[model samples]
Target: ARKNGRVGIVTLAKRPWLTESARIFLPGLDLEKLLDELQIPVFYAFEHVSRRVASFGTPNSYVAAKRNAMSECLAQLFGEAKQCSSAMSIGDSEIELLAIQELMSELAMSRFSTPLESPLQFCKTVLLRENPSLVQLQRQIESLANSLGSLVDHPGDLSLELGTGRRLRLRNHLGPNLR
Candidate 1:
């Protein structure tokens, strides 16, 4: 209906007679191992929404991320086809650009992630709006990216430390003296 919801999951207790092999859970796969492998930080930020439940981050990040992955893993539980609706306005990209001024010098690839930090609220409100054109969203993302001017030029080996000092040395050339 509204594209996003949430619910708890449970394994059915009743086993009907004449149960087929397809009804059984397949063995041999390590469920814990499978979940640990996902990119937890990414999925936490960009939530997927669809016809079924809208899952959030849990102690079991794998199950949460999987249900959130591609929106409504419950649909898969029902063995139905994926949503035909295409609200995937955002293109496929591993990088989500954030707005940083010239003074700042940190670019983190961790969770609680953000793509833009200026004029902050509006972008999010319009992200799922069907009325806005795709170009508008792209512009928003680009505008957000452009705001982080430091990233545009300082593309080199660098690090951002929390407690200590310098941690990166990149292969960049020094400029001539302006004397």
Candidate 2:
């Protein structure tokens, strides 16, 4: 299909037997690496299928789930014009390009109805702010551990003073060997 200038998409089930089959057929070949080299995108049917559709026991429901998963994969493929172009030749048809743009816009709006901050962005915002108490506590723990010296064989200095004026010490009542 690729040699004939047609895009080939593969949909696979999420199962261990696929790997076993690949091992038997190809013998030491990296299936994923081969797929990458061929520029073939592989979509796992179960990954894209919604939980609700997947939960249904009917054969029709199973078909619907597979269809839904395929729809998502196709949408993702066609959603970006550059990606679509790289995958296969869409030519310079203005109408097709305009349609793709419209589809992408629709997909974006449908997927994200409400504005949301990504977890990474939220984490960056949180990390940028300084927390003095946490820093102090961390420093105190480090200091305490340092004061204790090598805790492997023998116990060194057993007492330490924290920055908060609290005294921390290993109990002497436990005797010399403190495992």
User: 116-161, model 2: which lDDT tens digit per residue?
Assistant: 3111000000011123477875775575446332322233212223
Cα deviation of 154 in candidate 1 (Å)? 17
**Top-scoring candidate (TM-score):** 2
Candidate 1: what lDDT?
A: 0.26
Write down the TM-score of every candidate: 0.17, 0.38
lDDT of every model, 2 decimals: 0.26, 0.39
lDDT of 1 by residue, 76-175 (tens): 4333312221111122121111111110111121111443321111110012223446676565556434433442223332222111223323321111
Q: Which regions of candidate 1 are displaced past 4 Å?
A: 1-40, 44-131, 149-179
Q: Model 1 shows how many backbone clashes?
A: 2
